[model samples]
Target: MTATTLAPATTEVLIQLRPADEWLAVCPLSRLTPGRGVAALLPDGRQVALFLDRDGVPYAIDNRDPFTGAQVLARGLVGSAAGRPFVASPLLKQRFDLSTGRCLDDESVAVTAYEVRAA
Candidate 1:
């Protein structure tokens, strides 16, 4: 395996509420497994669920499930609907748009979506 070079992350963005700065290198791109979601604990103790597709495209959202109030979104099933990537809540089976964090089952309830990119 070859090692890739990246600019040092001098300052970490404290995302108390949601992620910020599109260029923020939160983690190594290689850490994520395709078609699976992983939980990343932010500096503020907030847990964010990050999903990667087979193509290595990344999506991030709150790890909590609104219906059950459980922090298990990271273990949800990943799929796509109408060309939009979504993650189905493991507890309620509610589909959440990974790009926007909109709940397909309930429009009023939504989670925080974060912008992610390969470093």
Candidate 2:
């Protein structure tokens, strides 16, 4: 029997964010390391934090920390709690749910969660 060869996987996947009506390409998926995040500046002057989970799921949220008003969420640490993925603020240590952008430490506080996709 003859053996068949398969094409090598490509890191051409692009991470996109939908801040408005259209989806904007942020960066290549390979640029995002699992459990780490990167910051992207939008056309409207808004900053967004993009993350890739260990499971290869992409998430996007407002980069600004609601409590301190600092744009440093991209530098936050990512992990999961109660089966929900979250990122802890580097400054205040407050955890924000990556899916919903809700502050896990405080139910009343939340940030904007953008719809993310891989294209």
Candidate 3:
């Protein structure tokens, strides 16, 4: 009978499939001015416009123009509802939901909205 002992490997390998938190820091609140909108680049390479409503709360919405698929929503106009935040498309003047990414005028298409904060 023969007995053999195996030695353990000294090196450790670690692989991460996804980020601990899906959120990636985009910008600082100081850089994102209030009452004005700024374009934020996401980790996935998509752009979103972050705006602060008249009440000074932050809202985020896709930067793409829903009608033409162009990246022009960042240059669009920002307005408010009874209190809800919204962005108007620069191309066709269509309004979209800042929270749920739903088109106010159209129902079939939708953009994306991300959770935003002061950096």
Candidate 4:
């Protein structure tokens, strides 16, 4: 669930999640359309929302609504401020950074964001 850049000399670049000891792939990168999002359940039984920005960079966050504990972050609306992409909480209209998952409304909490790349 961490995002990191990798480089290998003369090798084709591929962005992908670090393989877990018992990991599963839920959705392919092709399923995400720019400026749109898709919700999927992980193999670990967690729900997550995956988004692609206007630049086609992928981001993933927990789908759970922190304010209401509802599984609605995936249904939340997406927008930008200045140049940062954020997702609004569907229940309370709070915004969170898509890259870091930091709650814009409350600095005390943050959701998990997974590292996403073209793979």
Best prediction by TM-score: 2
The clash number for model 4 is: 0
Which candidate order results from sorting by TM-score in descending order? 2, 1, 4, 3
**lDDT tens digits, residue span 1-119, model 3:** 89988998664321111212655555555555556677766667777787767666677778888789898877778776666677888889888878777888888988977766543
Question: What's model 3's TM-score?
Answer: 0.73
How many residue pairs clash in all the candidates, one count each?
Answer: 0, 0, 0, 0
Stronger candidate by lDDT (1 vs 4):
1
* TM-score preference between candidates 3 and 4, better one: 4
Tens-digit lDDT track for model 2 on 35-96?
99999999899999999999999999999999999999999999999999999999999999
Q: What is the lDDT of residue 19 in candidate 4?
A: 30
Q: Give the per-residue lDDT digits (tens) of candidate 4, residues 1-119.
A: 99998786664433354335433455666677777678887767888888888888878889998889998887778899778899998789999899898998899989988876665
Error of 4 at 107 (Å): 0.7
| Backbone clashes in model 4, listed as residue pairs | none
Quote model 4's TM-score.
Answer: 0.77
- Alpha-carbon RMSD, candidate 1: 7.1
Instruction: Write down the TM-score for model 2.
Output: 0.89
Cα RMSD of all models vs. native, in order, equals 7.1, 4.5, 11.8, 10.2
Candidate 2: stretches off by over 4 Å: 1-11
Q: Which 10 consecutive residues of model 1 have the lowest summed lDDT?
A: 13-22
What lDDT score belongs to each candidate, Candidate 1 first? 0.83, 0.96, 0.70, 0.79
Off by over 4 Å in 4: 1-24
